[model samples]
Target: MTSEPAQHPFLKMANVNVALGDRNVLHDINLTIQTGEHVAILGANGCGKSTLIRTMTCELYPAIPGLDQPRPEVSLFGHSRWDLTELRKHFGVVSDSHPGLYSTSRAPDTAGSSTGRTTGLNAVIAGFFSASTLWPNLIVTDEMRQRATEALERIHASHLINHLVGEMSAGEKRRILIARALAHRPQQLLLDEPSNALDLAAQRDLRESLRGLIADGVGLILVTHHLNDIPPEIERVILMQKGRIVADGPREQLLTAPVLSDLLGTEVRIGEQDGWLHSW
Candidate 1:
């Protein structure tokens, strides 16, 4: 019956469990995410990454049976996260096909060449309503608009404010979506595969941008399948396999060849130099 995401230390999960179609997809999960710390969630595809994402946002299931008795109850700021409205104050979500966040937005009175254009700036504006996209009579005000625009500017997407939804490049769209998430200035950033499909330069840019946010003390939860995608800023990683946690600890302790190889069920070697982690 709490509301906030445990403002005390950070985000914590105690004996969390999740399922899909009567088959448990996640089991007995315990994790902690503190403010200003960037944590990565790494696993093979369908290893419960998305399920964990939905759980953090309180969008997973209404009544995760057995929650009261070690169920997948989500809490933030030392309170239950059932209150969708208050729950968002500390979390921002980004995923592929997040609707208007992608191209093909149906905004009227638009100009030509709307293809691949991202009006994601508007989605940043929609953060006040906790919506993935803008809607009719959505109750926005002048101050809110200013804040949203400022957030876009922070991510250097102010110029794309009026760009058609389908006109921007992949990287541009991604930045806009991040801007939208940051527009609310949530305490924690819940990112899902942030580096997927991004080229080297774009990936570098993303890395550079994250430095500032991490320095600012924002808690970050990132997910990716590649070990290289885990940023240097990430202090901890929780490896998942078959919907269960395999290893969890400091980046150095858990991201090594032995740990990673064990979790991955293969003989893998890990190397790190200058904060970049790679596996072979």
Candidate 2:
């Protein structure tokens, strides 16, 4: 009998370099994340964490190979190129900086004129079309609606289904955005600075939701500067500085005060409670 074919990693990069505008954002990067792995990319601001995520999602491309240099390798699920729409089916992305996600427009007469018209449910449904909000021209089937509702329930945000996106609080909006990403049931989720604007209670709630996803076997790739944002379920940590990864190892090995202090460019203190790491 033939052995089963080897599985490709969810994401892989080798000798990768990325540049944006006048600056090089990622340099000679080599990374791999297998299926079902929960990993965190941690770093200070402008360390290229977001740029790396973009590269993985195909929003950015690696630098062209020089005349005499071997080509850089950047692939998702073992494919070097992809149709973006099809790629979204495999990877769901949530980022605060994703444009038009919460764009505001004039609301109807019943709601405040300044509020956004997109309701939480509609926003989630837009995931099927890869659009920020449902457009009149786009077709949304009943099955898609059902999936969106289930996604909200999974994230524990069903109460916000009818709430206008602009009317909900920051935490509530985040849950909706996560649900939007989950609507299609992607194999993995990519979150960029997910807790950026959440309050303490909201942060706790978000962590609980993330833990639920982990328990359900959905993989996560979290990119954040805050140590607290690294969920307990994430076993691996990759620390980045100045556009390069400085350390890649188990969470326990890389989250020490010394490692963090060097990564963050300051003296650091750390503590752990319930498998979550916090720093000051």
Candidate 3:
């Protein structure tokens, strides 16, 4: 009898060793994220959460396990080899620095600063070329514009299309970033510290926007240190400590008071209310 085809996980890193300047940052890491899954990577600062996200997004490569051990593999959609740009088409990434890319006001003396306002539509259109702002040399077609508009519409930000990026609120700007990333119609979205520098109201709006994306069938991988940053849709939780994965399981299994306390290295009380988690 013939055997079935091998299953391909959406994102997989097995026996991964990542180092920076001879100092090992991640050790023997093995993580697998399946299609359509919502997962949150939780940890304090310098716990390797950002490194893990960067590795998953292909911004960093895994190191050889050791001289005696065979080289490990990092796969996206089951393939280890990829043209970076072409591979980016498969998924979109949103990092904390994304908002800065929308900045319009800058001192003339600031090095590498370009001063210009970007409308919501233009912001989304720039994603087609992976540029932070629409530049003179970038070529844009009617279809690309339409796709950008549709992406904004999908995220309920079409109304802000004419608004300049500098004028929008933090929450609105974040939605525009989402629209920009979605313009490519990628299968998955990677978010790093998505709720950073947002007020309570903006955080609520951001969470709602995330729900909209999930409803549209976009898989999400969220990396954040805040408990409330995790939306209700995320089912799995991965905890990191000192550059290693300490726990990986369903949210319910990992978000308990004791576990969270240990993960954060503090004695705290955790409470759940209205599908949101808060700790003190």
Candidate 4:
């Protein structure tokens, strides 16, 4: 009897190429994450890590191969075709660039002190609508509210339900965003530079919150330049340089001083303290 073909991973891309305007942002990329696997993509700025995540989520499309060439493939949940709305329901994405956290007219330094914005619970509720805030025309059902409330509780954030996002601490606000993503009950969580603006203590809190999610069986995809941002639970690492992946392997193999130094184009000393990775 013939053997059946191997099952496609939950997310997979092979020979993927992406261009933004005239610049080639990603080249010959291949990534595969089986269901329930947690991975990190590490690189310096402009290394195309963000582009790769965007492409994976369908925000950016991979370039089609030339005539007679094998087609570049990107599949989610084992399927090549997707309805954008349905596709998004499978993954929760959080990014520093996410709106609603900062007002367009507000100064950057005033991020956590700005006023008249969505509250923490409301922000999580907005996830149901796929919006930064609930649009006036959209009708919210009672079930949506319950889900949002439960999401906040999952992260121990139910107390912030009534607090304005701009008035909360940076760490608290980030947890609220995580709650927003969890409200959707997605299979995986994608975080892009999650600890970008938090202080050291806040970073610790964020890590703790992420550990809780991992304990709850949520898959994580962490993309960041900061080594500390990679929670210890994520075992696989993909190192990128320029616009290509230079290494992909278990965390222990790829996070050594020499490998990290080469990946970031600078001297990097990596240390582990209390099961967390730190680089300097």
* Candidate 3, 1-280: lDDT as tens digits: 1221124577888889888888989988888898667889999899998778778767688875657886788888878766656655667777754333322223331223431377789878887776667899999999999999998888778898888776677788778777777887877888888888788988887888888888878889899988988888888999999999989999999988899888888986888888988878
The regions of model 2 sitting more than 4 angstroms off are 1-6, 100-115
User: What's the TM for model 2?
Assistant: 0.91
What lDDT tens digits, residue by residue, belong to model 1 across residues 48-101? 888877776665652365535745545566666345655555666666634333
What tens digits encode model 4's per-residue C-alpha lDDT throughout 185-254? 7778888888977998988878888898889988889999998888889999999998999899999999
Models 1 onward score TM values of 0.83, 0.91, 0.89, 0.89
The TM-score leader among the candidates is 2
Q: In candidate 3, which residue pairs get closer than 3 Å at backbone N, Cα or C atoms, i.e. clash?
A: none
Worst 10 residues of 2 by lDDT: 101-110
Residue runs of model 4 more than 4 Å from their true location after superposition: 1-8, 98-115
RMSD of each: 3.9, 3.7, 4.2, 4.4
lDDT, candidate 2, residue 265? Answer: 83
lDDT of candidates 1 onward, in order: 0.70, 0.82, 0.78, 0.79
Ranking by lDDT: 2, 4, 3, 1
In model 3, which runs have C-alpha deviations exceeding 4 angstroms? Answer: 1-7, 97-115
| Model 1: worst 10 consecutive residues (lDDT sum) | 100-109
Position 200, candidate 3: lDDT: 90
Q: Mind sharing the TM-score for model 1?
A: 0.83
